[model samples]
Target: MIDLKALQNNFEAVSQKLKKKKIDAALLELLKEESLQLKEKRNLLEQLQADQNAKSKLFPIYKKEGKDIAELKSQLDQNKEKITAQQEVVRLLEEKLSEIALGVPNIPDDSVPEGSDEEDNIELKKVLDTPVFDFAPKEHWDLDSNQEWIDFERGVKLTKSRFSVLKNDAARLERALVNFMLDFNRSRGFDEVSVPFIANQDSLKGTGQLPKFEDDLFKIEGENLYLIPTAEVPVTNLFRDEILTADELPIKLTSYTACFRKEAGSAGRDTRGMIRQHQFGKVELVALAKPEESDQVFDDMLSCASDLLTALGLPHRLVMLCGGDLGFGAAKTVDIEVWLPGQNRYREISSVSNTRDFQARRAMIRYKDGKKNRLVHTLNGSSLAIGRTLIAVMENYQKRDGTIAIPEVLKKYMQ
Candidate 1:
């Protein structure tokens, strides 16, 4: 959620910043008007209460003087009725204000590039080098030839399309990647956490995934819980509605979880292979930092993920996401795309984001600074999406004889 007080105080500045995200001006105007109306209604209610109090006091004077009290009683009753009506009005306005405010996306940082989509995103730098192949490289699905590594057909029989079962080496490789990524993150000062794969609506909303993107989630048939789309949701929400001491400002955590998504809007994209799946394994990095040091923490997180890819001998690049490409709650984002020789292109394997108090405000996660409670900046990233990394490994390490070699770093884990 955005800072409503900031919006109310600096409407023009807030409006200008939000415009980069393509927010309609009318929406902000409606929010402002609703906020103003709510304030006025609240003031009116206060006045009504004050009038009732003043009139109620007069009843005692009338009784002491032995004067007529019927008219005084009637006025008090009428005022009480008006107060009830005014209270209802205030309640409705508050609801409307909350609905509009909760739907607003985070304000883009001033450093974010202005663009409309991923194509407009700026590339920072490329890491390692794109592998040179002696022969035509084959896509992951076709490279296995006998379907011994990945069983796409049987997956559909059990579930549906966009589902696949990793078999033999592929299964072991997936598990190895998870363990290696977790260990790598832990070595970098992040505490390891085990979080539930299912999250409640409040948890989702805190991370800017609910109400707006609920369609992309797989909800329980008759419950408030939904299969988590990423470990970020549950891990970040761990501090929800809590306040920590300033000494605990930068709380870094890494988690591994099975993620599920409905992929509702993606009707016909990445339908084959593990690029997009209903269920996938991921090693996630989440951090909560003080406002003054969030930028440094963001850099550390970016390096942590990018370095992981480099260690695996995977060629990748860091690209800054433009305003349009930024996630709902992120003020800024960087996507790490790994080289896939078979696809003959780099595919996104991780995305690091600094939400900068966006999730904190929604979750009420604050840190005590002196006598004040201040929101903490939240950051989340994938050290690497395990399935996508596996695809990259298969395509990059395949020999001419159709055998796949594990990355040198993952070799120990494979044992």
Candidate 2:
């Protein structure tokens, strides 16, 4: 959540920053108004409680002097009622404020470029070179004309559209990709972790996926649990509502999990292949660092992901996401797009983001620094999407005889 205290203390500054993310100015104003009202009501409630305590103390003096105490009792009773009413008012205002605050997106960093959408994103640089195929490249789904590797029809029969079953080489490739990515991330100082595929409402909310993107989630029936859209939700939330010592300033972890999404917002996009599947495998990187060192950690994460692609000999490019294209909880984001020979263009295969203290505040993750407790900066990135990487390998390594060659790095894992 955006800091309400910061918003209240410097409304104009926060307001300007949020504007870049296309936030409604009027919403910020409403938040400020509710905060002020809550403060006023709390003050009134405190005064009433103080008055009640002072008046109740007078009872002893009244009894000692043998004076009538009925009027004093009546005044105290009325004051108690007023206090109760004021408390309720304060509670409601606080609830309203919290509702508004949780729905607001994080303020974009000053370095983020101004843009309306992905079209305006700035490309940092390209890696390697796009492969030149002597034969015209075919999309993943069309490469295997007999559909031996990926079974699409059965997937629809078992579940629904946008779900596919990998078979033979494709299945092995997917597993190998996950293993390779995890081992690669571990070598870069990220400890490997195994997290649950299911997450509860609180976990999702802590990662900024709830109260706004519910439609895009696959919730379990008759329960508050939902299938995780990404490992980031469960991995980053491991430290939720916890405090860490300063010595553990940076916590880096990598995890591989099956991810599910409803694709509610993506109606007509990438409907033909596994590019936008309902279920897929992903290897994720999550980190928590002191605020002062988060930027360097962010750069490290970006390079880690980019270098992973380069190791596979896949051509890709790094793009800086503009304010409007940034994720809901990210202050800044850099996306890695991998080249697909069939599509003749680069598609996003990974995104590394630094949320700064945004998720920490929502998750209540803090670290002690000398004599003070402060929110730790949180970051997450996809080392690579398993399905997409397999697709990239297939298209880039396809031969004239309609056969796919495995990359040298993943060959050992495939065996």
Candidate 3:
């Protein structure tokens, strides 16, 4: 959640920044009104309590003077009733403020481009060159069908639409991609971790995936748990509600997990092949750093993701997300889009983001330095989305005879 004081002190500036992300200004208006109401209610409650205390003191004096204390006691009793009602009002207003705060998106960083959507995103650079096809290239679905590697029809029958079952090389390819990504990140000072695919409500909320984006989640009935949409949720929550020493300022972790998403608003997008799925494997990189070092950490994370693509010899490019395209919790984001020969365009395979204490504030994650403790900055990104990587490899490595060759870097993992 955003700092209330910051919002109040720089209301116009905050509102303008949020407007770049397409957030409604009315939400801020409501928050301002609720904040004022809470203050008023709290002051009223304090006054009532003070009045009761003052009356109690007078009661003793009246009793000693043999005067009737009945009137004072009656007034004190009424004050108590008023205080009780006022307290309840204060509690309700506080709840309203909290709800609004949680719903508010993080303020985009100053450097973030001011655009309205994905189309306005700026491309940073392209690495490697798109593969030259000897013949008319086939889409991933067509290639999978010709090679019998992915069983899309049976996946739908077994589960539902947007779900697929990998067969033979395709299954091994996904596993190989996960191992390669985890190993690659682990070799780069990232501790390999295995987190639960299911996370509790607090964990999701800590990562800023709850309350607002609940529709995109798979909630367990009669319980507060939900299937994790990314390893970011559980892995980033590891330090939630805790304060770390300054020495542990940057905590880096990598995990491979099977993610689940409802694709809530994406009705007909990427409906073919493995581009979009109900369940897919991904290797994620999550880090915690001091606020001042978050930008550097973000750049490093981006390099780590780019390195994975470079290692696989896959052509890709980095694109800076515009304000409107930024994630709910991210202050700034850069996406790695790998080239897909079959699709003949780049597709997002990973997105690295630095939330700049946004998640830390929500998770209550802090670091103690000397006499003070402050929120730590949190960052997360997919080293590579396993299924998308698989698609890239299959399309980029396909032979004229309809056979797919594995990338040289992943050969050992496949073995």
- Candidate 2: the clashing residue pairs are none
Tens-place lDDT per residue, model 3, 363-385, is 99999978899999999999999
> The CA-based lDDT of model 3 is what?
0.91
RMSD of each candidate relative to the true structure:
2.4, 1.9, 2.6
**Model-by-model lDDT, in order?**
0.93, 0.93, 0.91
| Candidates 1 and 3 compared by TM-score, better number | 1
Clash count list over all predictions: 0, 0, 0
TM-score of each: 0.94, 0.96, 0.93
| Selected candidate, larger lDDT, 1 vs 3 | 1
Lowest lDDT 10-mer window, candidate 3?
143-152
Indicate the residue-level lDDT of 357 in model 1: 87
